[model samples]
Target: MNIIPILASAGITGFESPAAEYSQLGCNLDELLIEHPSATFIGKACGDSMQGVGIFDGDLLIVDRHVTPTHQDVIVANFNGEFVCKLLDIKRRLLLSANEKIQPVVINDFDTFSIEGVVIRSIRCHRPSPLLSNK
Candidate 1:
């Protein structure tokens, strides 16, 4: 059997709305966005080095530790004890930036480095959001 979902625009002020007509109780953002809950984490992007890939400063990043990092994949890593987000070049042993202004970094044997996780999802806030602000 085929099931068709009805489009809805619910606007209720403390009263029971027509939401009961829907099959599911509600939609959960966590359920939709997160795949591996235990291996997932969220971080805020602090620089424009990844702006070319649409990950701007102050954007919310959802990193997943369970996934393996492939070549040219956007990833978070611990480079010389500091956490940074960059594009991984597995074969070249380099960390690349999405923005042209930023140069790619070479991973040398002397430099301590480890891939932390993959950046699976990103969220951008057009307006100032209280959740992302220090206030």
Candidate 2:
């Protein structure tokens, strides 16, 4: 979906005041967030394994297949035929877990270990919905 650009300021502030004139901020969120929509897929974070990196359980991950996997990039990869998300160490060829308790996964073979996509963005809902929340 195409997003309409909103008139907003770029600077971060503790207080917000009424704008004198409404004008485009010269940017759109959809345009900035999404590069290739067709190749991008959404995945839900399942556990606290990535909590150190702020990726909590139930968080939505924006996976972009078009982007090239790089060093220290959070990625969804096939580890021994199982799909998992972890930090990629390209030079060392290892998958590092965010949680300190979990041991880093060393890449044995490049064939079986395949990168699905790079995690472009992460989304979390702070507020619970009325339907799901118990009063």
Give RMSD to native, each candidate: 6.5, 5.0
Number of colliding residue pairs in each model = 0, 0
User: Candidate 1: which stretches are off by over 4 Å?
Assistant: 1-26
**lDDT by residue for model 2 (6-97), tens:** 55566876554444334445557566777998899888788888999999987879899999998999999988888899999999988999
- Residue pairs with colliding backbones in model 2 are none
lDDT of 1 by residue, 42-81 (tens): 9999989999999999999999999999999999999999
Best-performing candidate as measured by TM-score: 1
Instruction: State the displacement of the C-alpha of residue 100, model 2, in Å, after optimal TM-score superposition.
Output: 1.0
The per-model lDDT (C-alpha) reads 0.89, 0.83
Which candidate should be chosen as best, given lDDT against the real structure? 1
Off by over 4 Å in 2: 1-29, 128-135
